[model samples]
Target: MKKRVEHGLERFIFSSRWLMAPFYVGLIGALVLLLVKFVQELLHIAPNILSLKDSEVILAVLTLVDLSLAGNL
Candidate 1:
């Protein structure tokens, strides 16, 4: 009986791997968005680096880093 119970529990755990598929997909989507945003920010800064305040650049970079961390998680 104990062996049967262990076998059932193991099967349940293994079957649940599919449940994480959606989460991984969502993470990929978020990573793509982050890449787009990073590129946008770079484009925005390239033309008028002097016009953009230092804080603005820092904030944008920080946002990119935050998105990267989220995607990695």
Candidate 2:
């Protein structure tokens, strides 16, 4: 009887994985937001890339690095 109860409890706990589905969905949304921000940064930098001085380029690269270092990094 004790062994049966233990197995039932294990099954019950395993079935609870669905409880985390929404959290995973939220993470997906967060990733989408990050992707959009990176695209916006790219658009903002595209036009000035050629004319940017060394210091300006460094700043832009740092911005990209910062974005990449988010939890996804």
Candidate 3:
């Protein structure tokens, strides 16, 4: 009886790993979306860099940095 209980507990512990799979997939999806946004922001800023005022350019650069930090996390 003790051996049977031990075997069942081990099986449960092993199978529990599957429960975490969805979380991993979700995190990957979010990161991919973040990357897409980052590229979009870069493209948006590039062509306008020369026309933008100093303050506006600074703000745009800061926004890119923020997105980069978020992706790293």
Please say which candidate is ahead in TM-score: 1 or 3.
Answer: 3
lDDT of each: 0.82, 0.88, 0.93
User: Which is superior by TM-score, 2 or 3?
Assistant: 2
Q: Report how far off residue 69 is in candidate 3 (Å).
A: 1.6
lDDT per residue for candidate 2 within 1-73, as digits (tens), equals 9999999999999999999999999988888888888889989999999999999999998887788778374
Predict model 1's lDDT versus the native: 0.82
Task: Check candidate 3 and list the clashing pairs.
Answer: none
Q: Which number leads on lDDT? A: 3
Which 10 residues in a row give candidate 2 its minimum summed lDDT?
64-73
Task: Write one digit per residue (lDDT tens) for candidate 3, span 1-73.
Answer: 9999999999999999999999999989989998999999999999988999999999999998998898888
Give each model a TM-score: 0.68, 0.87, 0.74
Stretches of model 3 off by over 4 angstroms after superposition: 1-11
Deviation from native of the Cα of residue 8 in model 2, angstroms? 1.2
> Lowest lDDT 10-mer window, candidate 3?
64-73
Q: After superposition, how far is residue 69 of candidate 2 from its true place, in Å?
A: 1.5
* Candidate 3 accuracy as TM-score: 0.74
Model 2 Cα shift for residue 40 (angstroms) = 0.7
lDDT of 1 at 47: 88
Better structure of 1 and 3 per lDDT? 3
Cα lDDT of candidate 2 equals 0.88
